[model samples]
Target chain A: MKHLYPIKESKQCELRKASPETIRFLLDYSKSLKIVSSRGLTFESNLN
Target chain B: MELHVDDASLVKNYLNGDEKALECLIARHNQRIFNFIYSKVFDTEITEDLFQETFIKVIRTLKLGKYNEEGKFLPWVMRIAHNLVMDHYRKNNRMPRYEGSEQFHVFAILEDDGVNAEKRLIRDQIESDLGVLVDRLPGEQREVVRMRMYQNMSFKEIAERTGVSINTALGRMRYALINLRKFIEENQIVLTD
Candidate 1:
């Protein structure tokens, strides 16, 4: 019979280890893209 | 900051044909929104995708005069993201699980640590295990966990967003934690304290 593993308990550490810098970077990048996309600017023009 | 642009003003500008105001609003609120979503999904790629989708929805809705300025804008945007996440699960037929309520596993995005391949292998294993565990939660419980942890939404806000009573939202969260605890104990998983 195949053993069924209940969900592991170790996944919580990811929450604590998340750095503010990473959060900020992800947000900024997403926001930049959103702004560009909303303005109907292609990625190439936005880059330049 | 040159001027402290209030959310309402920024929104009003965006609604009144000032598109740059939308950029300012995004710049102002993106970090909190991203962090909120990331906390729930625990996957960088998905979080990034969801973040963009959230703003896109926000733009669409605002254009359609769907957003009410009476409520806080950040929380309102978060509510949209929360709904989208639920929609995502429904479409995929997969439930989300809380990362923190489970065994304690860490993913390090360290630079210049000079860590060997062994450490990286361990990290990969832990992340994989974590992902599987999160995938096993029931849909309702998973939604609660995601909103509470990722979005950092208050019970009241969650209640309002999901259209459930506050007690109902809290009860779901309670059961979610209880079930997660039982799963961990049964599996004999050792979480890092």
Candidate 2:
């Protein structure tokens, strides 16, 4: 749905554009997050 | 097959313990979300924090088993980022302002072809932000803006390529700038260094 827009301009409610470094850091940080399940199981995912 | 996985499936997989699913999801939407946050805060450090926090909230909601938006993942994440940006401004007690200390013309940077290396970095950053805004214009206006800014096309060339008179192309450009100004002012987006 976001890809449907022709201009790169972000819509009022839409998010747009990211730097490579930001994305890399976010992915790494996301990997460190402990995703806890409803059953109390905690898991870590490796992004590398 | 990884490229073909949609957002909803990815979210489902992430909730089911497939961490790679969230990776795929983040990769898919990171640019827009990052840009969205960057546009509001104007500072990379703040944008980085907000981006991370936005995803943190996302993970918390998903982990709680309360996820519901099936096809609206990007917008949902965008809403989170937007709220975080607003919260940041609220905490600082300052409305987000245009980045530069002086009056800066967005179109001038868009048209600048002789930028030095240092200026090139700033210009590129501005162009990227403007590129996102350019994508939001109506069809004809967007086409004119893209041709003039990206293709380096003259008004005559734009008229020929777009099959319209020079005046019509010029009118579209004018209107596009008006709309862009309105968006910038209304959103208080930081498009400059």
Off-target runs (Cα >4 Å) in candidate 2 are: A1-48, B94-193
Cα distance off (Å), candidate 1, residue B176:
58
Indicate the worst ten consecutive residues by lDDT in candidate 1 chain B: B101-110
lDDT of 2 by residue, B2-64 (tens): 979889889988877888898788887777788888888777788878988898788877876
**How would the docking of model 1 be graded?**
incorrect
Per-residue CA lDDT of model 1 for B109-160, tens digit only, reads 3256676787777777766655565557888878887899768999999999
